[model samples]
Target: MVATVVQMTESKTQIQHTHRVFENQKKAFRNNPMPSSSERKENLKRLKRALLANQDRLLEAIDRDFSCRSKDESLIAEVMPSIQGINYTLKNLDSWMKPSKRHVSVLFQPASNKVHYQPKGVVGVIVPWNYPLYLAVGPLVASLAAGNRTMVKMSEFTPHTSSLFKEIIEGMFPEDLVSVITGEADVAADFSRRPFDHLLFTGSTSVGKLVMRAAAENLTPVTLELGGKSPAVVSPDVPLSDAAQRIAFGKAINAGQTCVAPDYVLCPEDRVQAFVDEFRAQASTMYPSLRDNDDYTAIINERQYDRLQSYLEDARAKGAEVIEINPANENMKDGTRKIPLTLVLNATEDMKVMQDEIFGPILPIVTYTDLDDAIHYINERPRPLALYFFGYDRAQQEHIIDQTHSGGMCINDALMHVAQDDLPFGGVGDSGMGHYHGKEGFMTFSHQRAIFSKQKFNSGKFVYAPHGTAAHKMIYKLFIR
Candidate 1:
């Protein structure tokens, strides 16, 4: 009873600190409402340098957080993208910040219309556990590029990485400009409730709804990067081996914890066995061995592990064919929390694996008779964060593009669309909303303040007051007609 009381007291104290930091960031943003391009560039440079300098330490922290996080996977999924995102922002910051000269109507002859992009005071980033570093740093890069003060709330599930991230951020930035907050779920709830100018959350759809609800208290605008069951469609004519290899790579990367990972595959009905065989071959080639293998990553924790295990159990009980691809056939029942790249065949909608976002290395293969059936299948469900189609036919590609909606898409590839620096990444409908990479990201964290200036003429006054004057009538005749 005493321990529970102490825990509550500590949580309250931490919430108070989080609130104080938020207010400080707001005050600081108000003081320096607009930061120069050079200042923002320097901030990006400092962040990149910090990440590079502490590369090994960050990877180690992540490895510790996820008991068997692959070092190569961390580099590929986390560090490289973060550095590239910063570089991309720095290179484009000046152009993005330039005031857009809008066309002034002929009636307003003496006035000029322009849109000046200004920082949206304080931005709150709620990072998810999977790919923690990249998610946190990616949004931070966008926020800094837009010259906004930022506070990142790291996930408690990744405690080791979160603690180290806080320490590194504290050393590099003053709390008023950039702060990293770390704690449990309650702390996250409190942080989301704070009145940030804008909030970006990367997590599950259910939690995203809660975050959006909290942000609504302050009428805070949000950019949600929520997860849904992203699908990979294999064209009837496409080579089964090619599609299977790419889908396997996407689903196996970071143990399928990616928000944009291929959650399921839709293949030709006759080719299901061939595609499954090819996927197993490709996965086996990638890892070769799962038990004590350094390249294959384990599930994040026991909770996630149990959840995935239950998914398999439920699917099997509901008559889905489970194919476990353990390359070496090693005993995996140990406490390593590693599950082989398992494939689910004949997945029905009622099964847990088919119904939920399978955020693990479990790929469900659903057979479709035609392309429209596949497209219709996707349309019937909630929009996904990403959709991958594997076919060389241009007409089929265009048809798919025109028919469906998703946050992003990759034709003839999977998971690579997110790495492109020029493309905007986001979700549609149930998957998520709002773009946050490339130019869209800069706009997302900025407020476009419209400005109208007049030097010596008062043309607007001609139609200002009098109801039926000659000047007003003349103005109305010119414009209304």
Candidate 2:
């Protein structure tokens, strides 16, 4: 007899491992179900405890990953938001989970209507490197609160943080109930193919399309939180310095890696120079050292650094004047590859930086003669994830909100609209596909099963036999018509 060898490929091994994990979770969920409201509250409490207990370690991991993440920023943006999400879900989950009483027409008064929110088994979350913990845990909190098992695929760019998260979570929850997978893009692709009940992804638009396509094989619902060229419009009424400070703070945070960061600035033609000056001044005060500032984070890796460099080079080559607000000094430039907090003046529509999302410290200033021109410019491109308008006039803010469509918007500020738990966070069209954050997040991961119950009595038996009779006509007119 000849001996035959069967080699197992990495993909096959991963698929099998994921299948086993899913089956185990499914079994646990079915047997020891999280159906009771009290159980869900307890689970959320445990998650909060885990986060608070490991706060320092989590911050350290993120700092190590980004090399310039500030403790204060991390706490406010990532840590606190996640904890608040958990708290919001805990307070409202009982009411959210209760079967909703639906309205019924008078003709159907004898019958009852209700919608029950049930757990969708095995929700998959694919997190991005930017705001890794918040993106991962935010969706996880919603899924768990809705009584579903969750699996997270951490980004490969932040390997250290991903590993630490896996270690921490494994110790807190069962592997089958809540697990984390850390690998490269191929692994993420494989994770997307799993037969999940629902999938949530946070990343670029190009990758969001791939995730959607992969999920289509299983007919799974997907929620994509993608980025775009979000614009910030500064009207004439707002104080230039105040507007500039807020915009600069939002854009400079995380070194412009935030998904909803303002990608470009729009202002009246007369105020363009003033806005640019204030922006440069604010950025200087905000980030004292372009190369060594702890508050200013570096690009994730060499590829992103190169991409930013290419974007600047392309804009410069195309006649756009570049302004470096705070360049790296000689002493601070020894081993650090830091791109200065820069601005691009006279940015035209054709420039590469204007055409794409400038996910870096480079800010583009575009001057417009009228508000209509600004609105037209925004409408011409794909809808953005967030829009910022800096004006004190409520009517003007309302006008902008009514005319434009975005994932979210902020008045007199930039990118802070997402912090409201009462509001849903998401993108429209090319920016992204679904919304999530408090009740919306819970509903996104849940399957609402509509149920109607009837007692053991069959009425209107005479109408079933004859469809062309007078009684049928009357019944049709009264009920159907």
lDDT tens readout by residue for model 1, 299-377: 9999999999999999999999999999889999889889999999999999999899999999999999999999999
Which predicted model would earn the best lDDT? 1
User: What does candidate 2's lDDT look like per residue over 139-214, in tens digits?
Assistant: 9999998899899999989988899999989988989789888766777888999889899999999999999999
RMSD of each: 1.2, 3.6
Q: After aligning candidate 2 to the native by TM-score, how far in Å is the CA of 472 from where it should be?
A: 2.8
- The window of 10 residues in a row where model 2 has the poorest summed lDDT is 1-10
C-alpha TM-score for every candidate: 0.98, 0.94
The local distance difference test score of each candidate is: 0.92, 0.86
